[model samples]
Target: MSKITRIKGFADYFPPESEAFTFMENAARDVFSRYGYRELRTPVLEKTELFARSIGEETDVVKKEMYTFPDRKDRSLTLRPEATAGVMRSYIESGLATREPYSKLFTFGPMFRYERPQKGRMRQFHQINAECLGLTEPAVDAEVVAMLWQFLSSIRIPNLSLEINTLGCRECRPAYNEALKAYLDSVPEDGWCEDCLRRKSTNPLRVLDCKVPGCKALVDDAPALVDSVCEECSDHFGQVLAHLDAIEIPYTVNKRLVRGLDYYNRTTFEVTSGEIGSQSAVAGGGRYDGLIRDLGGPDQPGIGFACGMERLLLLLPEEEAPRPDAYLAILDEAGMARGFLILQAMRARGVIAEMSPTPKSVKAMMRQANRLRSRFCLLMGPDEIARDVVQVKNLDSGDQNDFSVTSESDLDALADFLR
Candidate 1:
């Protein structure tokens, strides 16, 4: 009777799209490791309180966007809205303080936040998070930002602009909040979002995250967090800027740019690009120097950032993605079995090859190969098997050759051709 349908704000990453995700993951992993960061993985399902405490109770993620449910033991659990909390939970629980100042750690996986589906934001999203714990120097901030820039360059995502801000330390924020709230409270009541109205009381800083034009215009004269940074924080922010300039990476200080999390403190930054509109935020992260100890660790200082994989994938240029070099097509029933064996051989030998299990007409298979844009197609038919060889066709140039299938030596030739 009723047609089955997927839920709102959920999506599947098909094979073609997976290419970009994988490239981004690999690029991030390489960069983090090069910086001496290790990998730390935590469960996708975390205690509900972890995020509630870290992101803040009034934040959208905790107030309305988290995907939380009862576990088998009736304990509250949540599909992680973000990965940093899980990492914090692990560091404290696993006694990582013993490895104090753990540098350059990374995790790449899915993140869930049940918010309105927009251009870049998603209910079920993915992130390539790189965290460097136990470091608070502004130089650390520069390194983290540099790594992000290098990652985007590696993936050929263009036009990345950097916007950074200092949320100030605990001391500076209170005064700034008072000023910001005063400005917002002065605005006509009709201009603010219902959520902003709530924030005006609970977490006044988030009023800036609102998209309402009238609300934004009203806060235009609001106190800037950067200008209000305490002397020490101002120095740290200045040092981070100096490091960026020393390394030739340009940035702009946007005082109103508060990362939508309560734990984020000092040196917050975002990378944006035109390729992914409206959701153009390709990456963002900041120093959460206090989160480790707050989560239960022994007062360890750390700073790190996490980049959104889905957003980066959306922004990546087409030719930059890594794609399969070959699609092996089997033309008849007998060829299907042999084709699978060849597929195994190609993969074992490091060939970027693909395959279709079912046999199809030569015309249909050829069309499929072309549609996939495979550089080469290896076609094996009963006729070729009798000759104890396979037909290797280069789709790029329409060149054809025959090779014996009896040895690894023969497959090496195919692999080389695909290369």
Candidate 2:
């Protein structure tokens, strides 16, 4: 028989890394809630059409990366490659907008994509997403970006910078697309990457987002979408920048910062870190005014962002695991019985308490307690049990005291002392 191993590109998180995951999640909940956002959990699996219709069918995510399969009844299902599509599906199906026109929702969970794995990129990764629905105002865009900025800052992700761009609304985008496509066509085909070659005819905007060195160099002199937007889009983006400025959020207007999503329009933004190499973007999003209606719901506007947890984790400083408040060491059967009761009492009183499950020599138990990094150690043995008391040792100060365990009141006093 062979031992089973984890699938490639899937990872197992342990102590410190898992703790960091929790820390980031708690920070997201805290900062997002301050901005009137509530949690919304959607399933990881959805109809394949949900993504194909929401995220553009020509996009790389749909063309190459999705983990799609068929169920017993032959209906296609896909493990979500990103969160926004599922969120939109849920919003439309649940009539969320009818209930609360201005709904701000956040969610944190795993997303699956079948792509080449690299540092900070995995097949099964996690994301922290927030969506602001039912508003089309530029100020709302600014506010959503600000909230995302605050959440990342609160978690202390290092070397952060903000870059923003506008993809232009449907009315003005076609012109820019044609202009960009003409520029791409003039460039010799030999210089473009395979994907860019296909994209030039399919979706020209994605060429600017191409990371290939040759493709990037070719698009260097390409027309800027920001320079081509209509008056309304220009005004909308200007206001978004103004609001960010009013709130003291610094940003750079990168004309080439078109995010890799088809639904975005008007105001798109991304936050990158210098600490992470090449794939530096830790978070990005923008206004998607047409997604709600596209997903078969009433026409509503939305803006949101998603932070890649794996990428953000790369920027997080090393953290230590939490220490236990107390560890109970029992030296004999009698001590084991009493220590178990005391452990329960201490836990009931909110102390982070743990006890040895079986009898062990005092030295062995004490070593186990030390390994746990407990702040204090409670020792009980035949002698101590006979006296109806437990010896409490402050692991930090090397001080010892005896607490009675003969009565319920004694147990209360013992717990109080531990607290």
Q: State which candidate has the highest TM-score.
A: 2
Clashing pairs in 2: none
Q: What tens digits encode model 1's per-residue C-alpha lDDT throughout 228-264?
A: 8899999999999999999999888887798888998
TM accuracy, model 2: 0.98
What TM-score do all the candidates reach, one by one?
Answer: 0.87, 0.98
What residue runs in model 2 are displaced by over 4 Å at the alpha carbon? 407-409
lDDT of each: 0.83, 0.91
In model 1, which regions exceed 4 Å deviation? 1-3, 188-190, 320-347, 352-387, 391-402, 405-419
Clashes found in each candidate (C-alpha, N, C closer than 3 A): 1, 0
